[model samples]
Target: MMKYMKHLLVILVITIPVLYTVFLFGYHNQTQTTVIYHGINLFRGEEGGDQPLFEKREFTAPLSYVILLTLTFGIVIAAVAGLIWLLFSRWEQRRRLRSEKREERKERLYIEGIEYYFQGDLDMAEKIFEKVKARFPAFISPYIRIADIHYRRRDYRKSLELLDQARVNEAKRVDIFLRKAENFLALDDLGEASAALERAAEIDPKNLTVLEYQRDLYIMREKWEEALEVHKEYVRLVKHRRPEMEEIQNRLQYEIARKLVASEEGKGKAIRALREIIRSEPRFIPAYKVLGEIYVEQNRAEEALKMWEKAYKEHPEHPILLTWIEDVLYEQGAHEPRMSELYRKALEKSPHDRLLKLFYAHYLLRLDRVDEAEALLGELERTGGRLPLFSIFRSEIYERKGRFKDAIKALKAAYGIHSFNEMVFSSGNGLFEHPLHRQRTVSWYTWDRYRINTGQELIPMPDIQRVHRA
Candidate 1:
């Protein structure tokens, strides 16, 4: 009803002005008197002189100009409105095309930058992204990409500054928080990392990536109990029972146990936790190692060896148990005979375990029993021990026995062009990677000062000195 009223009011407003102007222009003050027949012949001079020749009738009505004027005015208004609409439509179309082209250029540059990034050209990728960002500052992707370039360049502070400069809602963007957390972690700012992770988790509580980052943050902080909790949530959120996830959870449990062993009163709890972990995963090397160490700390060497022996029964020729055994008993001042008997027993149990045989040979060379190591290496060769490490070991044994020529021959065999980097090795830290270790091992903050008291004496720094194999 109001709509009709507004339209009617507009028509009246337009038509009223047109009707009034037409009335003024069409109206005139003129005499329009009718003549009487008795006085009509005064001005007659023709054959019809008696006729009232000039009698003028009074105006009955003025022509109706209101409708005509109103129509003309309406047509004029419509033509002007249509012209304005046509021009506006063209202008809007051109503007839209320009905007689309601008967006396309931005997209093209972004794709080009991404391609360079994938091709491992960080400098070119960064330059292209800088151009994109300068021209299209509102684009979030360019900012992220540029920050990533800084991160890859190890300019963590610059990456963080760019993230801070992003004109976006930080709390609402889980990815931003995640990247910020990564930068903070790179800088070893655990507190800032934790805060970013917490904010990310708040934004996306069930996100697996967020939980993983949270778990990592806690692990870096050495808050094993908290890390364990976060890991549990990650496990719960995961849809599949992946071996990797199970392995990670087991490591978290081990770390928690390790932490508990830090305090005098927490030893028993730590011990129980370690035992529980071992029971759940008998082959988990770190739990066995740590538990054995703890038992040795409590003057329980017999028990430590007994526990390892139990696990060795399940995986008879496993290198981790043997190596841990070697380390522990060496600290116990293991003699040539004692260590030999240990290997001999293991070799007898797994006669065909080539890796085991290689390990034994390596151990012999370490003991400077060159003849025994050579005999074992010869046996390995006879059995087609094709492992590249076999050649490395062969070279070591040959060098030990004053066969420099043969040592060089063996060394050459290990580093063919394609196989130069094939024999790389990294030790496991139990069921997971050792916490907070990369580019360094056992950082000072996590390293136990009194490791000697816990039956973990320092082996020499050159425990596995390189012969320049790689």
Candidate 2:
């Protein structure tokens, strides 16, 4: 009813002015009348005052002229109104077009900036992004790109500032919130990162990017349960089942179970969690490892051995599980025959596995079977792709056999092979062209220090002596 009344009001407002104009003109046309007057001519000096004045004449406009005048006035008013409306419409259209062009230009610049960013031209990319931000302050893309550049440069504070500016422009945007969370995480501000992610979750609870970041944050803070929940949600969001996702979730659950096993009250829960993981993902080796450790902690040595044996049967070439199995057997004083049998069977299945061979050879060496270990090491050496560890083992065997000179030669060979591959010195936390050189130098220095401590002859390397002189 109100709508109809408004429409009626609009119609009346427009018609009233036209109707009044027509009515007033029509009334004037009807009421108008012609009038005539006769008077004496005062300026006529010769004529008598009473002499009749010249006949007076008068004229009145025709009714047709009044009607023509009213029609012409209405037409002129209507034409002027139409012309004004047309001009205003054209102006509005031009304004819209200009706005669209401006938006297009901004989008183009943003795309170009992204391309430059991908091309690794950070300077050019930064300048273009800055230009875009300056010209289009409300545009969020450039703000984010610039923030990313700052982040790559490790300028967390500046990155956060740009992200804050973006948030101000678009408070509800999830990407902006995620970027802020990343910046906070980079700065080790876990609490602020969580808060930012929470805000993003409120905006879009099922956003995959938001959930992934939330999971990472939880993991960083060691909030295992929260991370598990987020990972589960992420798996559900994905349409297809992925093996990696299942593995990640199981690993997280395994970690949680491990943490639980640390407490007396939570042991039962931990065991149940571990069992559930094994049941769900039998091939997940870490679950078996953790479960075996839990069983061993509970003094259930037999159960732990059974778990490891089962894992070995399922994954025969798993080096870690094989090592655990050997350790368990040795602890139980039943290692000899069982250890030999396990290695033989595993080698039969995967004879080309060098790491497995190394493990076997090391085990043999531990058992004082030096000849057998040497035989395996010789076979590995003759195979033409010997590892440095092989030479190290050979040196160990040579030392055990009282062949000091041969041992040193083997050690030098190992060092030379290692120099080409090792780029970082583990001792000093530095990189070098030949890490083995640094290692040998450091070892000699350490041995000399020991000799000095013992009042023995110091065997300093040539390089070390030069350094000491310098």
- Clash totals for all models, in order? 0, 0
The model with the greatest lDDT is: 2
Residue-by-residue lDDT tens digits, candidate 1, 411-442: 56755524323444222212112122222432
After superposing candidate 1, which stretches have Cα over 4 Å from the reference? 1-101, 167-171, 262-264, 294-304, 319-345, 352-470
Worst 10 residues of 1 by lDDT: 461-470
Clashing pairs in 1: none
TM-score of 1: 0.56
Q: What is the TM-score of each candidate against the true structure?
A: 0.56, 0.67
Local accuracy of candidate 2 as per-residue lDDT tens digits, 119-141: 98989999999999999898887
User: Model 1 Cα displacement at 428 (Å)?
Assistant: 24
Candidate 2, RMSD to the unseen true structure? 16.2
